[model samples]
Target: MAYCYTASIFFPSSSSSSSILANDRLPHLAYRPAKIKRRLSFSCAALPFDLSPPPIDHDLLDTMTVAGAKVSEDGVIGTFDNDDEALDAVENGVAVVDLSHYGRIRVSGEDRVQFLHNQSTANFEILHEGQGCDTVFVTPTARTIDIAHAWIMKTAITLVVSPVTRERIIDMLKKYIFFADKVEIQDITQQTSLFVLIGPKSDQIMEALGLADIVEQPYGSHKHYSVNGMPITVGVGNLISEEGYSLLMSPAAAESVWKVLLGHGAIPMGSNAWETLRILQGRPAPDKELTDEYNVLEANLWNAVSLNKGCYKGQETISRLVTYDGIKQRLWGIRVSSPVEPGSTISVNGKKVGKVTSFTTGKRASQPLGLGYIKRKAASEGDSVIIGDDVEGTVVEVPFLARQIPPS
Candidate 1:
């Protein structure tokens, strides 16, 4: 039986009917509106949404309700205790984070490989079953739509993307479908739950859970396992730590799996800790670094883009940027003296150079750290810059661990 689903696309609400076209900025490209505020809907065959698990109850844990601490938009706990304790758990021990908010889409049929290869930046044709690779979807002008990790399974390719971009990515994929192409796209997000184990002791915890083999697998590789009758697919990857593994399972098994991990000495981390960890790792977040405002190169996502691959959307723009050295700005790490808001300007010698995109207090250090896109010429590692007027900051390398002095 096929279930039908509808996704709504809402355009920007503005008084001006005039819209900016992509060709206006890049004359060689076909015209596409930069903004449209009308609400439109599309329908496709999908599994029942009811299959998704309900939001995790924070009351189940001895959570701390501090100011600025709350549930994430994705419905996961934002803070179990304090951010510092959470960071300590990740650095010195093991921590389990709920990532059920991430989206999962399954693409199947004989043409799946070729179709995905032409849709995203990664060379999907080279991925064999049980292997995975991170890929980015871009516009015709090479602007980022989203970054997804595709795991090749026996019957289909499972794409895990940020929750914010899930619907849009699915819509884009469906719109690109051709009548002669043998491809099927299904939203399996509701049917599955995703969680991550991070930190130095993550391997120990995995082994205790009877996933010793997964700890030895290379990044982007996964294996299936069953724990107490709950089927799980464990994948190796670095989400917020060098030692990290992701577990994907049915929604019905999520709670049990989470408890079992905690019972084995894994600290429960919430989004508050996640934000601090991600910023420290220099990993981009949805609607922050992974937006249309920046392209793949500017976002420093070269690892995810395959330069030698055949034509795909935005291939020309990416190639031109590389061939011409036209990347104006690049994402960088910043160590700030005090708290700063997103969109805070970064300047040097009284000149504006960049803007802070993501920031978090140093739960594991002395000051705040952030991610921003800076003009390549304006700053370099170890250089000092002004953030939002008089606040001073230093440009630093990402995975910002050098300055993480443990608090007294």
Candidate 2:
């Protein structure tokens, strides 16, 4: 006797599912009776496949808004009040900057170290558990990709990358994976949050939070801790300030941790304040100072590049530049007589020497300060240059604080 069988499948009734699946891919039930009188029927249901990102924590957003945070379009706090007060907090007291938006990725497996070593500019093979260092990802032609800070854990290495370059870096790393290599890359950016505590009082605040041990550790040293059932990892690093401590925790734990630090007198800082401080520190930021338009050396990120490291992407070009002094332009600090827009040209005697990448109204310095790339042969510290058309400025040493003190 012949038998007929049919199957039916149902997916969630949502626009997301409809957009994700095509009509032909959607299965339906069909039955044809033959000599047999009986027919079999099977039914299946499939969950909707949603490709949207997770929603932001509204509770945390509301809390910050209530606390007088000027939230940016990206949802980060831009400034609680003004940049000047935040600058003061960084120099005198502790200031907390939410860096949760930064990208976080976890690299696991036995070959993770060697895999990263071959991909980036740092010597990752030498790092031990609890150690971390900044590294740069570059193209084959030695153009800047992004500078990532890696924290070595017992089982995996956690990479903190720029939010803009997160997906690109992940895709780039995955493309290099081979069948013989044992490596896994997981993007944990949404799963975790990061905060940076800056200022001279950062150590004191850590002690108050019962993290005195972390404060004593050197830069790039991290230790994990469980605080009231929430897992948190504290690390020492000079991200924006000379004495900065980074706290990595779950999104759910961010509110509580932020409150705890605030209870200990940590001021809330925002992006405006961050930009001013970053320019003052002479730190290269993604798309601004760190970009494919310039090489890593030209960005003045030599500390992040390891000269003794083995072969890596763009290694040959980087080595040649160093050996032959091929780097023509170098990042420098410019003290402008007035505010100047980024992308403004820096000229000497009507000849184009460089262009500004970052410009900030010096609320702390009571002047306009900027960072840009200048031809090494055209400018030196204390050389006068014209910003834009007629705005006069002088080339100064980076970490602008070294050349002039911030006003009290």
Candidate 3:
């Protein structure tokens, strides 16, 4: 009989899994609404699969319509709204979208820090109280195991990675545990909930809920706080003009937090809006674009890596790629004349050169754009590439949106 699991935390038998040595480590880790709150009906009784897929219960489509967001399911559609309500919700107020499908993993034990630092692409030792980082976990050969946001609570490190790569992340991390001391890995994805607070006014929203005091810090930094009196682990970062804070807490707290945001005038956005924002910002997500073959450098994750840090697993390869300028391809955003699917191939002069990773109808710019991995030398803003007949795209900068100052 075949067994299946929704996440990548399961331990394989000794004979089935390879005991690989890890060189180093790294880290990291949304919401919804009502009125539009309808009980979704998805039938699984007659389906061939025995396992039940998690249902989409947020009344996502209605929520988007009521909020006046342009809604499309093809991954490129945005809701049609006057006053740019989607953008407004992300600017002046807060928004919650379903992010449960994203992957998450936890690392614990006395050696967790040492193990992660050696295997990850960032400097874990510099992680202090109220700090987080964007980083990558790599295999011994320098392939990316997972791109993650790492947060440290005391000595415990939590990595919120892409679900598509969750298994490899677990397998890869476990491979390096031979003879390591006291490190227990757990997959707490189902037990915990993820809620994101994004907008220029995000701080105010947090303040209203008593999450934190206003302060100056980089995008990947955060502090512990409470929401509606519920304790939560918080991590913050800049996603375009909107500063983002992710709440790691219980499901009950998750619902209460969403209610509080709605009461505070936050526009509840659907997953569609979130996807559009992510693509427009050039953030690489798993399955949609991020994969094993893509390295951190090519994925535009430079801000996440710390060169001054000591050796970790795959450091030699990463160092060489960073200094030697030997990476052949790099990920870039492009303005395309036509819509392309996520996995569509990109070409130049009739030769295959790259592949499209994510595409979106820019709700703000009123144009279609895509994220793709192209040959490094050929990947430049304003450079034109062809996808199909009469379908051409021009390379553009990573982040199409500008940042805004927090309220004083």
Best by lDDT: 2
Per candidate, the number of residue pairs that clash is: 3, 0, 30
Off by over 4 Å in 2: 1-58, 400-408
Top-scoring candidate (TM-score): 2
Per-prediction TM-score to the true structure, in the order listed = 0.80, 0.82, 0.73
Q: Per-residue lDDT tens digits of candidate 1, residues 6-49?
A: 33322222333333111111101122233444433332122222
Candidate 3 residue-wise lDDT, 182-209, digit = tens:
7877776665567676777777765554
TM-score-wise, the better of 1 and 2 is 2
Could you tell me the lDDT of residue 316 within candidate 3? 81
Cα lDDT, model 3, residue 1? 38
lDDT of 1 at 211: 50
- Lowest lDDT 10-residue stretch of candidate 1: 20-29
